[model samples]
Target: MGRTVRVKSFELVAKDINDVDVKLLHALSIGVGWPHRPKDWDFLRRAGHGIVAVDGIGRVFGSAMWFPYGHEFATIGLVITSPRTQAQGTGRWLMEQVFERCGDRNLTLNSTHAAYHLYLSLGFTKEATVYQWQGEAVSPPPPVPALTAELSSLSTANIGEIAALDERAFGANRQKLLALLSEGAAISVLRRGGEAVGFSMKREFGRGHVIGPIVASNDCDAIHLTAVHLRDLAGQFVRVDTREQTGPFADFLQQSRLGINDTVSTMSKGKRFLNRKENEPWVYGLAGHALS
Candidate 1:
């Protein structure tokens, strides 16, 4: 079933995203200057549910997706409208569709500059700014701070080992999303006294590898967790989206050659999505801008 929406002269139909061809979705994202590869789109399709705005001829004009972590919480992302249709109400219509489907769940999303006003007008409050950092991983990535924990490789088979810690940092039990992200991803975990303290995952995304979902109790540990992967990715493209605007962890990323590329505002429609506490686990890096 689909609903027809008039955006200017064209009548766009909201179709189930799963039914649309992946190539069409890729083209839609490309038209908006996003870096989501077709494979990345496919992975996201598997991670959540979405809808695509299509026309009578089957050309997609927009898309929106929501990842529900549990019965009462969800993160909305991947919302895009064709540049040609910008400001004609297509984006608003698409968000309305997402709202109808998401029901009463507490919602959050990282809004791009173009969509900030639209989201704010719809009742989303700004939470924080996420900094997108990326560059060729430098050789011998800035010296690590004094050794305080053991860093080791983590296999997906033992994903449960860090579930509790990740939930603590992210404010939800995203074990399922972590499991999906774990596939083909290089994982590293920081352990102290034989107990897992923090972890990070490096995976193929967009134009290069993204190291993220980095969880730690402090800036030093977060740096070590991220550096463990950066060291292995020397000379390769790496990206990390973090909310830490200023701190030792942010400084370390700059020293590692990951320059700030862009920023997005984290907005929530219900309960606050981010909750950081002293000496408590925090997300040093995000899994992805949309996935956050």
Candidate 2:
């Protein structure tokens, strides 16, 4: 069963979002001057699902998303509250709406400074800090044959393997999201001995391009795959949210001239075990804080 409510003089309804709601969410993202494109919103909703708050006039004012991977893991993200409706309890209401549908699965979200305490009150503890590296990209040196010799462009045929790899790294199934994000974007895959092992993508976003969701067996492989795509994005503004644990990877981005732009906190309510291989750091860069 679904629940409904009324806030102030406006009759508010909380329900699953449709394409129309996504457009409204996109407007909110742009109103806040965030970098997410409308297409990105589509990707998230299409990949998993979300709940939205709509007023009497059918204007969507708030939204929260969750991605479920089987019965084990899920990521809660893309949370946005309209500036006009801030501090009015709409945010909390929207969060509750999402929680009701989350069931007993573990939940994760990357929090902005403003919403940290709210999440804390909800029992989401801090996991690790993530940093955003952004700036004009530089021309990367030619790929070392030993490294990129096996790297190739990604296509529809690669989605399954990529999603399986992502599950091992992200602990979630985000095939739909990856496919939409990779559409028309520069996607590179690394193969060793004819076996797919790593991948990276660069997409037009925010002020320019962003490289992210880069998953590889290790930092070296991650860097190589990302570098293969970075060379083509040279002199363009790019953003990547690097995990704090990967200090060397973050430093390499800085040395490559991507300045540390900002930071966000990755928090979770339940234990989502990302039991991964030791040598495989998996994700050297994220798609974005909103989606992570």
Candidate 3:
């Protein structure tokens, strides 16, 4: 939609997304070879806001979704345009609507290379590079059986700790979104000296299980938390999106046979995107770009 050209007289109009419209959004993702399922989109919509472009017949041409992690920080994702509507202003128009809701909040997004220039034009600067790793999930025996952190499957009692650690690592409170994403999903917690220090979550996504929103005190605990949830997922396809701040986790995933799939530019348009302290635990893997 960067160019000034418009697709034929389709009479497109923008409107707030409704609960009944996730199917159309799902179609937009698959239209471009992405495997976002409607069920996952529905989960996001429970705590997110979105917009859709439509014509006189009410057919969807484009869609965009955003989650306001807090008053000062937010993230957007699942932006899709129907193949037939490229460069027709559908993507631009829908984004304008979503941005209005963001107001002064810092905005972050993981963008495809094709959309990188578009984001640059809109005031976002590159913050980091996110790599997507995925392949058949394999349960390889750990090189060292004694993982440093004591691993445990998350229970309802662990939600408070998980949410607090997530808030610190993510730079904002995503308690509601986390609750929805973790419901009935595999959650693993890392404890050191009988205290929760890190966690990882996995849920049904795309072709198989996707893990993310992982927070840890260090690389060792991060890999251990990931390994705990991934234990029984062998042979099932799995995916994780992560910034390359740690080479060991990426190396570990590769060692487990989850090959690097694609890379995206993680960009932000805001001030103070993250508040950090000396030696604070960092986010090891994102919930997914869409929800990040």
Candidate 4:
């Protein structure tokens, strides 16, 4: 019989809030073909929990990130394994560490085809199927009267306001995450008569761009913001994730002929603490590929 592989005894290092290792983590994530940015690390570190697997020789074998919105709701992402250590259970082990650390929280993750089975085995069931419309021309959206609201870019000056709006849109207080986004990613806010109404953010990736967390006060605003952001992409391809619940926006995507490229099932396990409103416009995109 073949020899059984012995589980490696690795130390799980929880990164210090706003630690510099975030840069290294971002690099590693990108190396694994994930769409991420150095600035994203700041957001993940502040708005989420991270665990790094360190071997006896002080080498990092794998890492996982969990972004929490409140006491019991979190979106997990950035699960990466060193190329040399793939299939060694490093990814699974890192996930176990995340579950152990955030057991009381309802977790969500957007798993790739290769990892979907692993996530399903962990009690995460399919909730919604996601699609990507890539390689299409980025056309400007028609002007809508309801979207005449003022648009603002997220910055340190307005992080609190941004966080409040985010909670209203996503149903949880993610102030720390806002702070991180302000630092690492580009965030745009839509305001009507100076009141925050919606927001969206984007992170750079090797392939192209992923737009998300496109939350708005109405369907029109969501479409306007998505069009504005997609227009900026111009020649490059863009990927957007729409939920089945956001009826209006989902309808818009369908009618616009932004055909589905691929889909992912949004699954969950454990009780969810945050009450997600069905009325809020569907999320046209998420903060990142991982968080979406």
Best by lDDT: 1
Instruction: Judging by TM-score against the true structure, name the best candidate.
Output: 1
A best-first ranking of the candidates according to their lDDT comes to 1, 3, 2, 4
Query: For model 2, how does the per-residue alpha-carbon lDDT over 127-173 read when each residue is reduced to its tens digit?
Result: 77888888887776333324544878878656776788776778777
Clashing pairs in 2: none
How much lDDT does each candidate structure score? 0.92, 0.76, 0.78, 0.65
What is the number of backbone collisions in each predicted candidate, taken in the order shown? 0, 0, 2, 5
- Candidate 4 backbone collisions, by pair: 127-266, 212-285, 212-286, 213-285, 213-286
Candidate 2 regions off by >4 Å?
19-23, 140-149, 273-277
**For every candidate structure, what is the RMSD over all alpha carbons to the true structure, in angstroms?**
1.2, 2.7, 2.7, 5.1
Task: Score candidate 3 by TM-score against the native.
Answer: 0.92
Worst 10 residues of 2 by lDDT: 140-149
TM-score for predicted model 1 compared with the true structure: 0.98
Error of 1 at 249 (Å): 0.8
lDDT of 4 at 162: 63
lDDT (Cα, tens digit) per residue for candidate 3, span 1-292: 3212245875776667773477777877888989888887777777688877777677877778888876887889878888898777667776777788788888988899877887888888997888898888776624533586678888655577678778878878888887877785788888778878888988888899888878886677778877876677888888888885356777778877887799898888977464546457778888888877
Which 10 successive residues of model 4 have the least lDDT summed? 1-10
The estimated TM-scores of all candidates read 0.98, 0.88, 0.92, 0.73
Ranking by TM-score: 1, 3, 2, 4
